[model samples]
Target: MSLNPPDLRPDLAPKMRLDAPRPGQPTIGMVSLGCPKALVDSERILTRLRAEGYAISPDYGGADAVIVNTCGFLDSAKAESLDAIGEALTENGRVIVTGCLGAEPEYITGAHPRVLAVTGPHQYEQVLDAVHAAVPPSPDPFIDLLPASGVSLTPRHFSYLKISEGCNHRCKFCIIPDMRGRLVSRPAHAIVREAEKLVANGVRELLVISQDTSAYGADIRFAEERGHRAHIDDLARDLGQLGAWVRLHYVYPYPRVRNLIPLMAEGLVLPYLDIPFQHAHPDTLKRMARPSAQTETLAEIAAWREICPDITLRSTFIVGYPGETEAEFQYLLDWMDAAQLDRVGCFQYENVAGARSNDLPGHVPEEVKQERWERFMAKAQAISEAKLAAKVGTRQDVIVDDIDADGIATCRTKADAPEIDGNLFIDEGTEGLAVGDIVTVEVDEAGEYDLWGRLPA
Candidate 1:
């Protein structure tokens, strides 16, 4: 019965659930934090452990040791990661910390000196070494074979396909490039091969993710192998052929992105884009060292809509950044009104420890930042309400995500991404619908960020 909150923590990964461990298996628990990218890292580490005959425990009490995969994107996230590490340390007594926060080993050790070890993000071997030292793996070669799709932290229905690591952009508000380093894309064939295995293993959706999805192969010069190219457009086309829902995330608004619209229009991929247009004002964007082409972006949006009318545009924005004037904030509101983006998320800028924006002049007061956030969210909500209202009579194809005991089926349309966007709920006649089943429903009612639908006769 809950609608999508106005302030969704889109950066969070879906909660993890693991199968029971085999008898006498040395189990390790994982506390995955941060974005889906980090979640993928956790999955990789767990898969490697599983391959070596280690079991994944879902909780501290059941674990021999725990891995705290941390996020250090924002000050708040850092605090949360530290808190998670502390809790894991207390509950399990043995913890290995790895992730963006692990990049600052002294910071973690300063907070929790009891941690067994700390390894930076995606350092699988180091994490494994730490784990092997903490809890020796007992390989039951007859039973410890890894699954084809590996140890998925997410549900079997959908998987996050990280095409690349790190980012090249040095935005003032971000330290990702500093922490994760420059873009390093996976080979085209490797990604496609992974996707094929995921599909074969019952994954119905592929959430393509990266630090900057549009720049997937920039570092590799868009290399081609086995009939697949590392470029975003080519990759999307390749993934689309796998017969699963392909949703792209963290895409920058590059001119080349327009090429993907035709693929969406052709039903090759989901007609959805999750871009982060941090701010709309040119000055604000320039200060953030981001592209300040608001006018060009609006035109590109219009062009995209013309090509793929059903496309759902989802974007996140940062408000009240350093040097943001009230006029600049209002300009953003005006831009939102004109753009009429289908899905939106907003953040009130806060200084991360190493971000360049901290030294920028004219930092807005905390109260002003909160006030701007409220106003921005209000605008976004009103737009969302109207947009959902318009879909009241439309028939949408939704993938069932869950079915409650009361028989309410929670589903997401092509316009919706899992966990972040609005949902279409089927209140009755959900007897036959199971998780991952796609069905057509007639929208009967709508709220600010959700819809009530019924199975079509």
Candidate 2:
């Protein structure tokens, strides 16, 4: 029997199948960590397990075994993943660890040697095998069958659609390619069919994700349709017809990406781009093995804004990479000021063990990195505040995410993504409002990060 409990932890996977078991049937609990991409993997795993008649327990104590989908993107993330493993082991005793951190099984087994199994990212079959060995599924096809809605960790209104797997970029500081392997695009028809199913099942928004969305059709040679191949442009065109908000994420600023702008303008897709600029300085970008020509990119940004004035461009940058001089940091600041990007995220550099950046010269000291991070955040915050202040008078369409017991509703506009970006709060006129309702709100107040708006009486 399925027990649908609201997942309180935003960081945990949203689409979990918390099914209470039949007598003598094994139930598996999972603690999913890391980014939305990793969470998607967890969703896929749980979906497969559910199909195999393996019930999912919401808490570790009630489960026959637990799966910990981990993150190893940064040192901090790895530490958190390890802590989660310890927590699971302490609570349930039977734990299986997997994900990016699982790529290095020794690191995990060294800390928690009693874990049932450790497997790397995308090793869904191995994870199932481990689960079978620990808590085998006993299927009663008629009794244990799943719903047509499928297993999802996200809310019913939205879903993260991973169009491809892995990265082709060899950025010095990143090991995603190592952890998740090279680019592998799905067939166009397959993606569309999944998206169509999602929309048909009441998914109102689709967050398209991958290591590099711009590199989507490259691996598959773009042959997804009847000889048309699965290219992003075509994929966007096809998915746009599903009558849901299509938000593209992790798109590199490749030349081909420009082709997608017109779709946003034409109202086929949301006018939002979550690109990672990394660093603005040419020298720093070169050291990190990224595109260093900022001039053209800035020009392209201007051109994109011209094409779609309502477009919201979001980007992330690394502030204190190894060998990142003060001038380079200043260039980044200056670029931020000039670009006036709609949304921004900054990170101070952390040395991953196997990354080439660790071997580079002039690693910034920790104290300096921290100070630079403060300065970098200050600059971005000021820019964000100014940009948000400009939107105070405009009316925006907002999708309600949640409403509290006190009747206050929290919502997001097309420009605001689910978590990373800001939110819109509805204080008054929330009588008829409900989560997932799309309503018009007049921007009345703006803060450094969030906005306050209310519906018309």
Superposed by TM-score, candidate 2 places the C-alpha of residue 341 at a distance from the truth, in angstroms, of 0.8
Candidate 1 lDDT, tens digit per residue, 127-235?
9999999999899999889887899988789999999998988899999988899889999899999999999999999999999999988898999988889899899
Q: Which stretches of candidate 2 lie over 4 Å from their true place?
A: 1-25, 226-228
Q: Which candidate is the best by lDDT?
A: 1
- Judged by whole-model lDDT over C-alpha atoms, candidate 1 comes out at 0.90
Q: Compared to the true structure, candidate 1 yields what TM-score?
A: 0.98
Candidate 1 segments whose C-alpha is farther than 4 A from its true place: 1-8
| C-alpha positional error of residue 280 in candidate 1 after TM-score superposition, expressed in Å | 0.5
TM-score of every model?
A: 0.98, 0.94
Model 1, total clashes: 0
Local distance difference test scores for all models? 0.90, 0.85
